[model samples]
Target: MMKRPFGIAVAQLGPIQPSDSRASAVARLVEMMREAASLGARMVVFPELALTTFFPRYWMSDEDAIERYFEKSMPSAQTQILFDTSKNLGIGFYLGYAELTTDGHRFNTSILVDQTGKIVGRYRKIHLPGHADHKVGKPFQHLEKKYFEVGNEGFHVWQTMDARIGMCLCNDRRWTETWRVLALQGADIVAVGYNTPSVNIHWPEPPHLRMHSHLISLQAAAYQNTTWIAAAGKAGLEDGCHLFAGSVIVSPAGEILAQTQSEDDEVIYCKADLALADTFRQHIFNYGAHRRPEHYRLITERTGVGDPLGKEPDPS
Candidate 1:
């Protein structure tokens, strides 16, 4: 008998502001979830910082604002409704948020909740960007570094819906190590979500088609790792900045299965096969089987000050 193809959805959310209520956000998710189910998706993935507009820049001096935006727990009363909705629909999801710990360790977090409404696994973002201090010329895109600490939990993978799933937040996909670690863990699909803006004057990448910012990073990661990737985005103009929107899903064979259009909330849908990952794994490109770790001793070496063989010591 031939194996069946699994399915996934890229839920590209539009600009959700500080003014957007939790009920409204949950409603949007409900609609999207139904839409995905209609498209035959077994699973769906939302963008990083999905609950609200990316808030790292505000320097949120008012503690109340911080608590209001940060999710203290998964399925908080407002979010539990989403879990219930997914359970009813029998479609699992991967969600990202600004998580506030009980012990006060805030992090950029992502979690996998099954169709049965069970939390399967969680991951905190290891790569944190933006400055903690307010920049005079740059306006308010400041302070993720000062607010939420870097994620302590390393990269991870989960088994869900007959597929080996993996999760990563914004900025994590920029580093190959993110995909490599999960690939080594035997990942079949990698879920990534972001809320990238149009202008930053900082590390602005060019678009492969219409815009330089989106698509490139996602396609690169999906193709290089030989794993399916579903990338969702919070896009469009929010508080004067235009967030780029190009949510997409790619197959292990480097084919773009689906992609969302610009500046609006949309769902890009496609069927993902759990077994296609074996095509890459069985080939010489398999990282676990063919990785040259012995030659990789050079990455950690300080090129100028230290030698790979540790022949020289730093002058500092």
Candidate 2:
């Protein structure tokens, strides 16, 4: 069979300080987009909350956060340059930002822009991590649950750039069900953006395990679902808190084809053979051939671990 190759890039961004203006951040993104185009990439993926500092780290009023960090419109005055450049370079991009709706709903969102600079798809983050209450003694807060509402739109894939593309943001990538839903929809490539802290605020987790879990999640997802994955991260120190950088592009065969070497603004590209997934999709990972959905009802029926299904209750 002939190879169906696609060129993709992951643009890893450095920290955006709390005082940094949106204009400055967009300029950095435009620079990386140009570099990715020059390197022969058809599309690029940027990290979560790329427009501002990771504000969820601080506890603030919802109204204040929305006014300071959320975007009312995608191509507003500050972000128009990204679309213009995309159209000029004929390169598509995936960007993550805070989206405030006209109806007053806020979401941690990511949009998929085509070569024409038009947004073809959008994904709101569903699996919001962290607590709504302020952790009094912790160095930083993870207030995603408090600031943003749960995503309403379900996982979806779009046909563009001659391939099926799906998107998920931050913590969503850690869930297997997220990958399975997209793969079931025939997704060829999955784009993920994240802003993860280097330290665990809830427990004394070894810092190294953060990077390890990030990489392993993508590798396992790619191989199991037989889809290409491009993950971008906002790394390095921001306001004294550090985020690890291991942005990577994983092939369907569970291999890291490319990875960012620096914890700064970097672009890593790979020309992947899209057809390579067919070998596994048609055999080992073939959902239609082997999946037993009937027996997996517990996944959606309950939120936490419980007694074994069909097991008899112990006599009192």
Alpha-carbon TM-score of each model against the true structure: 0.90, 0.96
> What is the model-wide C-alpha lDDT for candidate 2?
0.94
Best of the candidates, lDDT: 2
Q: Over the stretch 1-316, how does candidate 1's per-residue lDDT look in tens digits? A: 2455988998989888777887788788778988988898888898998888777756567375467778888889889887998899899998999888989888888899888878898989888867666667675575677777889989888877887889998788778778878888888888888877666645454433334435666677777777889989888877776678878898877777888876677988887776677776777467766788889766656443446554645533
For model 2, which pairs clash?
none
* Model 1, runs deviating above 4 Å: 1-4, 62-65, 203-213, 300-316
Residue-by-residue lDDT tens digits, candidate 2, 1-316 = 6788889999999999999999999999999999999999899999999999999999989989999999999989999999999999999999999999988999999999999999999999999999899889899999999999989998999999999999999999899999999999989999999999999998899999988999999999999999999999999999999999999999998899999999999999999888888777997898998999999999876665675655534533
Q: Which residue runs of candidate 2 sit more than 4 Å off their true CA positions?
A: 307-316
Q: Supply the TM-score for candidate 1.
A: 0.90
TM-score of model 2 (CA atoms):
0.96
lDDT of 1: 0.80
